[model samples]
Target: MRFIIIGAGRVGLRTARVLRQEGHEVTLVERDAEKADRARGLTFEVVDGDGSRESVLQDAGVADADAVGALTGDLNANFAACLIAKHHGCRTVMRIDEDYREEIYQQYADEVDEIVYPERLGAIGAKNALLGGSIQAIADVAQSLQIVLITITDGSPMKGYTLSEVALPSDSRILAFGKANDPLGIPLPDDSLEAGDRVAVLAEFSELTEVRQLLVGDESAAAAVAGGE
Candidate 1:
């Protein structure tokens, strides 16, 4: 696939390199001379101009692009570039920094293949590191919801329970289940949870404590459940 990345800064450059490593072609568009030159130094094809401008995008071969990612820090420029890419029949991904505007941009997400908040994702990583558990956040579904992956351990409440028998919080749901070192799949009612098995679940913030208690009976999980009493 041919991808056109708007901006040649850290994220753009890294994304391009990874795509190229995955056997995809990548072209970068940068308004800054230094950044453009730097991208070129890395042996990437770069269009030296403002990516939001039609002419500049045309110079970058946007018409032939399979996908276009607007990863610059400027939201307006990213949106403009994504709009042009959409018009050219290319899949578009626009990056935004602020979490407050996630809902506002979600309206445009269907139009632009995706609207990503890189900073928010970084913070989620830090948060997962801070809260040590068998359950770690994979992604934030919304301001009040998260998608988490949990590995069942020995003595875990979930172990030995079938999908139908296990009870998660009201606002939480298991999406998939898998054995240790295996890929996750849709859980079946007859499937039994076991030690070393993993489950991915979507959970509301308020129900996180309950979800943890159901999966792993840790001290913190017990404390949280007790505190709620």
Candidate 2:
């Protein structure tokens, strides 16, 4: 796949590197000479220009791109770049800093394929940091659903419980489970939750608190996890 990234800052450069590592062709566009210079050393093609402009996008071969990632910090610029890319028949992904404005932008979301919130992702990171090692939110799915990976810590209420014995909230379900060294797969009735085992669960936003209680034990466990640095 050919990807055109409309920023040369941390996010764009990192995206380019990961895509290039996966053998995808990537082109990075930026307005700053220094940032463009920095991106030139990476695996992607680097173009110095204002990505919000049609001419600059044309120079970056956006018309021929299979996908475009508008990652500039400026929301308007990112939105404009995505619009141009979408018009050129490229799949567009735009990053928005403020998640609260999502509904307002949903009107234009059809023009773009995906909306990303790095700040929300950062909050997940902060949660992991504070939690120490028990539960981690892996991804935020569409609507209020989320995918989370949680470890069966010592003395957890879930420890020794069978797949069918564990009670999850109505809006939540365990998707997969595995022992410490085993490959993750759908949990079976015979499978038992043991210390150090990992489980993946899908839960709605409102049910997360109850789901956490069931998986992590109690409010004290949550407090201990949340109080960590």
Candidate 3:
């Protein structure tokens, strides 16, 4: 696959390198002379000009690109680049900063093939490290909902139960299940929950504690359940 990346800054350059490493051809477009020269120094094909301009993108071979990644910090520029790329029949990926509102996301989401939040992804990695080993946050489904993976431990209340026997809170639902050392897949009714097994659940923020108590019982889980009484 061939990819055209806008901006030679941190995110754009890193993405270009990864794609090149994976045997994909990558080209970079940068408005800044210094950034363009820096990319050229690393032996990458770079077009020198504004990525949002149709002529500049044409100079970067946008017509031949399989995909376009607009990863600059400027949201308007990113969106413009995506729009121009989309016009050329290329798949477009637009980068959005953390400062954007939900409405802003919704507005641009419909116009691009994909929207990427680099800062949010980094924060999710840090959050997972702080959340400990038994539980891992997969994604934020919405402002009030999250998808989490719970590893059943020996102390888990549902450790020896079957999938059909497990009951979650009203706002939560089991999404996938996997046995020890296996990959997660669609949940099966008769699949037994054993220590080391994993279950992925989507739950509202308010119901997370209840889901944790039922699926990942620990000392804190017990305390949370007791405190609610």
Among the numbered candidates, top TM-score falls to 2
Window of ten residues with lowest summed lDDT in model 3:
220-229
Measured by TM-score, how close is model 2 to the native structure?
0.90
Worst 10 residues of 1 by lDDT: 220-229
| TM value for model 1 | 0.87
- For model 3, residues 1-229, the per-residue Cα lDDT tens digits are 9899999999999999999999999999999999999999999999999999999999999999999999999989998999899999999998888635545766746658878888776766776676667888788777678888989999999988999999999899999999999999999999999999999999887888888888887544533211121
| lDDT of candidate 2 at residue 82, scale 0 to 100 | 89
TM-scores for all predictions: 0.87, 0.90, 0.85
Q: Which residue segments of model 1 deviate by more than 4 Å?
A: 108-111, 219-229
For model 1, state the Cα shift of residue 214 in Å.
0.6
Scored by CA lDDT, what does every candidate get? 0.83, 0.82, 0.86
Candidate 2: deviation at residue 22, Å?
A: 1.7
On the 0 to 100 scale, the lDDT of residue 217 in model 2 is: 73
Ranking by TM-score: 2, 1, 3
lDDT winner, 1 or 3? 3
Report the Cα RMSD per candidate: 3.6, 2.8, 4.0
